[model samples]
Target: MTETPQRPLRVLAAMSGGVDSAVAAARAAEAGHDVTGVHLALSANPQSFRTGARGCCTIEDSRDARRAADVIGIPFYVWDLADRFREDVVEDFIAEYEAGRTPNPCLRCNEKIKFAALLDKALALGFDAVCTGHYAKVVVGEDGNRELHRASDMAKDQSYVLGVLDEKQLAHALFPLGDTVTTKDEIRAEAERRGLAVARKPDSHDICFIADGDTQGFLAGRLGKAEGDIVDESGTRLGTHEGAYGFTIGQRKGLRIGTPAPDGKPRYVLDISPVTNTVTVGPAAALDVVGLTAIKPRWCGTAPTGPGTYTAQLRAHGGETEATAEPVDGELRVTFTEPVRGVAPGQAIVLYDGTRVVGSATIATTTRATAGAL
Candidate 1:
């Protein structure tokens, strides 16, 4: 069977000053698309340089992006969306933590900044699609519906983060790095072959806005210091903390608790109540959660009408577990086949059917497996 030839499109390629994005733009241009490279100025006061690859959105990164666009032989421009990014991603992150929830800012950025704001602006500018180097695929079905799927490289697969995209956003999305099953080294090699300079550039890690990767310090600065009590499951005061927002569920270290567990076992953060300004620590077994309730669901295609078997991913780099999920009363309720540990509210719960993305929602609450449930 002969495949239909793809018509050239007016593509807006998002260049992140990294090898992956540079090569993605190059490939899009090579495919006969009218590609224009763009870098989003997501920081209000961009740093002069990055501290290794620990963060991004620096002045140095913008310059690197310009150089990559020059090598790709495409028109390049930087769009200032720093205000939107601060409001949508950064502030939302702070607020989530203040409410005693663990939020994934990357997923929120993809949903709000890249796909929504960027795609909307691109469409207004007559661009047919917004292309990126994300390690995920946008598969078009026989009925002409676009479906988000995992990339060929499972190790670098990023479909979980892209699960928040709805059908409209997926329609105008292009992921040039998704179809290849190459390793990170191979991608760097390809970038070198193409004369792109970021081939050896270190991949960005940790939270981008948190330059030093000290999330506790960052939150403390923003939320201010409020002395709180650290207690065990039995309501016995173990120690004191500067703030309740400094800890997360399943956290095992930096507890600074003066007292040790009665059974001499390592304790983990079991609960955080901002209202009471209390941080609760207990055994790891008490962290097991059997079910969850999620809100603000976003689907890639049609919403599921009935309960269905799916694999749920609780974290960006975490493993998936078998679950039965259904959408009821504008909320997603999921029951895991087995108890899972360290489940947290405010984190996104992405559902997948095989390699295809089902949808995503912000986890609002969880049902604990043990009798000592909070």
Candidate 2:
């Protein structure tokens, strides 16, 4: 498993037709790996899959990947991963919303599709490893455990989307874009130089599976229109919402509450209760949380058993917050060293030990610690 495995490492690049994966395939081939390109057709997603050179999944991106494979003198193929995407990503997303929880679909996709399904397929095909453009690094420890780490390119670092990948996946994963000088701008320039059609295309933003980023609209369209009441923390009727699934924690806009609070400050969605079919609203400060409890955690390498602390990031762009995490009663008790703001439920809280990614979990809920809620 050491010593670079072997030359001409049978590498399969999960090409997304983006500049990064395009360049990744080329580099793997240049490095003498038996490189091939695989584009996943996520047609089940009810969005415009018109991805550019910057976004991951789209028709244009697939073409670019194929073109790159051609340029790199490798076979190219597109697998119909639409069913898998629907069952694993789209269904999970809908279910999460239904349960009044926010979800990271990208993380689910990586967990179920790329690292889980694709990795399995690669192993079956006898390919040494499957590679991608994820801006993360996989290092195999001397103990044979695989560790995940942030890429040198911090801005484009995709460790958040990769948090669900466990040790087994990381061990067989390759990130050619881990250490690179290719910024988004630089990648586009290189693609243009290589005459890729997607080089000039604008990048995709927002959720890809949900078209137009109208999450509410998408939920209504998919999850059947259900009316619900918006209430305060004490269960007093405040207003009515379209559905409980439409609102999320820390959301301040589009409350549609006709009555204004006495303080005149806009109320934020503190939480949603699907069982009660109610949405709770309060001042902005109510969203602040002191700690969280995460179940079914996935460590990049292996879960540590100690009162160790690490940098816990709540959002992708969110700043680091210190947290003491320990396995308690089968859940990760993450008590933030400092009170954290907008600690939303159903979001991913990625834990890192310096540069290495320790683990991540979908935030189930947070409770005010003995120190009190943040």
Candidate 3:
């Protein structure tokens, strides 16, 4: 007697028209999942090619995604998420920057759009899960609870950005690229072997809305020019700047200050005051943070039972340091064993227990050692 084939899963694969996403969709279909590739039309006005190879969602990218879906033997559709993208990702990004905070739009998109919006729609439409090419893993515990973990390829791990996903989101998420310990080149080669047109598409980087990678210009266009003073940590005026939104923490160059410091040492941007519209330049030591407080913390599974040590990463692709994390009134406070630098408010502080992602939160404030205290 012949054995019956296993039934396919009803999957909605999000194809970003890149090699990674194309290969991911192909793999999903190859695994006998009833996969349907969907490209998100994020940009309201998408060009054929974006400037500086840092942009995506152009007409070419959508076409390439559709072609890849055809090669993978799956149905393809373009989902118009431009309005949602603008409201959730683009406008929120501008608002965060205007408030003198460093915001990660990629993380915001993953949190609000991909996993939240897309996943919700997929579930409503009877899809089992929303698949993506992100380099992160979703595992099931012995108790059947979903767990989010780092990718096997440590070099390409994207668990930092995905820390915002809660257990519900992780339950309906599938990452085909996370299980393998292969490099990105291997994925592209697989796409090529499968006759996918996006096998060699350039990787999208930088903020997608800012086509030329000129974030300052993009913000200036939306928010008209505003003059502000560039001052030292002591409140002494060093120079004047066009806008404070253009600056970020730890920025050294482009201060446009004619006067040098008394010590002739290079100064870095220590603080940005949206209230006073002042950009503060100071010594690099001022950027060192001994501790931080984060609000609206989201645990991937269960909140920590008690205070303990965890590895905290302040930025994407940044180094992690062992820190003591305590839950305080629905917020999290982390004290690093060793002081970290360039930690910006509004950025995510992802906590990890070994390789498993414990939780994440948006930094609200940083604590610095006083000069006299040291």
Candidate 4:
């Protein structure tokens, strides 16, 4: 008979009432580990919390998690981390906009909440590791190095979203659903076959913490609106906009501009200015970029001691590109192989080599990074 992964004594499975997490908890228990199901209360209002819950965390979701725990015969609890969630994830998201940059709150949440805060709590409670439903593979290499690889099921690969994780975090983490279950569709079918109640729950979309994908509305609700000028590359005042924070690089709609492009083309957001409340708009070609600057660099493993050539990804699930990376102060200067378009501040760029993650950073700025040597 085949053996299961040696469960490290006890595990804290992060349950969000989804079929993936439910199966993860079950797999952990089946592997012969002491497992406890914990739901992270990341929303300000648990009773109304539906971001993570929206995937399945409704009252029905909590009940489904509880029910799954019961079926798996494990202990379950809810951790109220709303304040930290707001500060670390939600507030950070807003601050990125205020600074005229985009931010990946979900990536930040994984860094701050899932791996850091919750992992610390689990260790304090004597748990050996934390488990989740992310679709990525973690492997201890021949040299005893840990690296995250794309899932066996490419369509469900979440390594892009999880690109921010370092070796230390991946070490104490378990993606029980990565290879065992190839797809969410497969997992849901398994749950139903097992007679689990959360079998047919709809998948969550948009930013889980935000209600729907009304990012502009949410930002306006919190930071209030400021009028700004929409300009072209020649510094021509094409139109006015609501605020700089309401737009992102590569956005092609919702400008509400009175006039169309001079070349009979569509306009795209090129730049944002919080100080002047000004947003720059131009032809779609203006948004195409070659290189970028990144901040808060993190190497998946221990970062190389000096400059190194590496593969980099600008966005989650985006294709990989060739680049040379060097750590400068807290930021990284990455020169890409080609001119990359839609390079935006606040999004994360994760570096990799083969299957191993090299480093990652929040893109604070991009001036077409293709000029530097690779």
Candidate 5:
């Protein structure tokens, strides 16, 4: 864990009504800091109860957060950020899909809502720092700079999603749970010992806004139906689909194509073209990506001046791959040492120097490896 200040500071804990956040807030308060708990009301109309933890921002979650704050003896309040969340996260998600790309809403929420909007508001209120339950560390470097690093428990490390944080944001962030090299079950036990009611609460999963976990249905409702052709690499029509936006790169299960490949192998979605209103399908080999160009890079500390070798994580729950990355123009250009599969546009590509996060960017394009390269 990063060394806590000897002097007690004012901390605004963002309690997300989970066991993790509740415990995090408790630890902050116990550290002699003046702590206040606040839960974000992300949805305008929150559901009564979550469907087995498939979603969050429900009415029950707010109540659970309030109870946890009470148990911790901290002042609690609800912040209505529904409008900001809808505009920044929900709308951005729809727009990305409509543009034939896949976006990670969790990253957007961390960047825009949690760190940007929430931190700005906290600073205006004279708060010293914003504390959360994210499983990532903020280490004060020898040069007096704050660096973002992965958690001790690699299984629960959330550094990939938090790569969007810049140097300014890192200076005012606190993560109390990052250094604990214990299993999640032990954390729950700690919460129980602390009398936090959320000790047994299930962790939220999937896209929170889409409660049913039916992403295709959600997109269909917003984008409506625009029937398009599902074609092959050679532009040969293999089948048809209701909407091209519904498919993502490397998706294999729902292609619904009646025609099989020449080798009778299952086909996967290779590309989506919104301009042509087409969804291209081919064998899985075509999904191998050798290089990618990403836009709007955000560095945790200092930006890299030249090309460097680092491990790149393409998705939130994905494994890292060795890559050489450099800043070119205003974008990040990365070439993987070995081809990686299922890399999609609009997704975040986070670079790390071992356990420390280097930066992150939104993937705009990908270069596929040669045929049979994989």
Candidate 6:
């Protein structure tokens, strides 16, 4: 009997020392590709133990990745991306907060580190594609153009966070986990069946660079002390705060206000002005934004022709809203069919036509009837 021939494709699998990535790498090898496991060392100073899944890039994670590689009989290497992670992700996060914008570090990491940096290096080194454990599908359309779509499991779909990836990046990307119709528990069972030690490893939930999950404290230490006034929509001084950068839109707690609203209702953060160093709080109604302007549009394929309706997801974990997205010059103007709440600046608004990702952009401004500002 003649043996089946292997496909002539070299794949670089990004292993995060978790069951998902271990299973992904194993699946790649099972598909008869020349798979090489590469773990990204994103932390400059990794802790010895990863506490409660707070840090994903600890030294133990690297070791676990190596052991998984050994179990799968694949060569593995750790790429020290600490400098790039710091400059592109960590510093950018700090700067965005300083400018009073709420940025998603995970999206920045996917845009810069995983896709750009890793994909570029993989291509230069003669690899055909860069594979990962992301829960998002890359589908090739009838026109032979690649398009990103949500995973089969809606609960674990990560397509929103991966919206920044353009068509060119999607062309050379592979997501093993995305192809599966199974849950995370099933993936762990697969790892256990393969006798991988990381099969039962806890999934990391916090920012990789942040050892502790205290985002405010982390920012305070880096941003220092900048006293600011807590005010209402009409610029009435309501209280005082340590810094304006610490507050995010839609935040309700920790305002340090001495008095409550006239109606005694919960007041949400409406805006954070870095220049004036003011944090504005108002009723939940004020947070309802009807339309938004998004800049730096990135499309998975060619953007929708002219103006059209698309399902717009405002945040990573938010529900989809019906919106009409129109391309004006290079930016996009999205008018929501229903007023949405907590549309913050610097947050990504990913557009979708059905399940296929149309594009994404960073929200620059949000407006409503009576020209309510944010």
Candidate 3: regions farther than 4 A off = 1-8, 48-55, 370-374
Candidate 2: C-alpha lDDT? 0.78
Query: Which stretches of model 5 miss by more than 4 angstroms?
Result: 1-6, 48-55, 371-374
- The models' CA-based lDDT, in order, is 0.90, 0.78, 0.85, 0.77, 0.90, 0.86
* lDDT accuracy of residue 350 in candidate 2: 89
Error of 1 at 24 (Å): 0.8
Cα deviation in Å at residue 285, candidate 6? Answer: 0.7
Residues 1-374 of candidate 2: C-alpha lDDT, one tens digit per residue: 23223456889899877667776777677778888789988875424653432356667667767877787679999988889988998889999999988888878888899888898998999998998877877766678667788877888888978888887777678887776646888877877776665566666556777655688988899888788898766667888977899988888899988878879998988878888788888776666678788877888876788779899988876778889998776678889887777776788988999978998887877975323222
Tens digit of per-residue lDDT, candidate 5, span 124-191: 99999999999998887788788999998999999999999998998889999997786789999999
Backbone clash numbers for all candidates listed: 0, 0, 0, 8, 0, 0
Off by over 4 Å in 6: 1-8, 48-55, 369-374
User: Candidate 6: how many backbone clashes?
Assistant: 0
Candidate 5, pairs of clashing residues: none
Off by over 4 Å in 2: 1-7, 44-54, 142-144, 369-374
Model 4, span 1-374: residue lDDT tens: 11224445688999888778888888778778788998876765655445443653355567778887787788999788889888998898999898988887778888899888999999888888898888877887776777787677867777777877888787778887776536677888878776677778777656766665688988998899888789876678988877789999888889888877778888888878888888887776666566678878877777777778878777776887888888877778877777777778889998877756676788877874323211
Residue 253 local lDDT, model 1: 90
Ranking by TM-score: 1, 5, 6, 3, 4, 2
How far in Å is the alpha carbon of 36 misplaced in model 3?
A: 0.5
Error of 6 at 330 (Å): 1.2
Per-candidate TM-scores read 0.97, 0.92, 0.95, 0.92, 0.97, 0.95
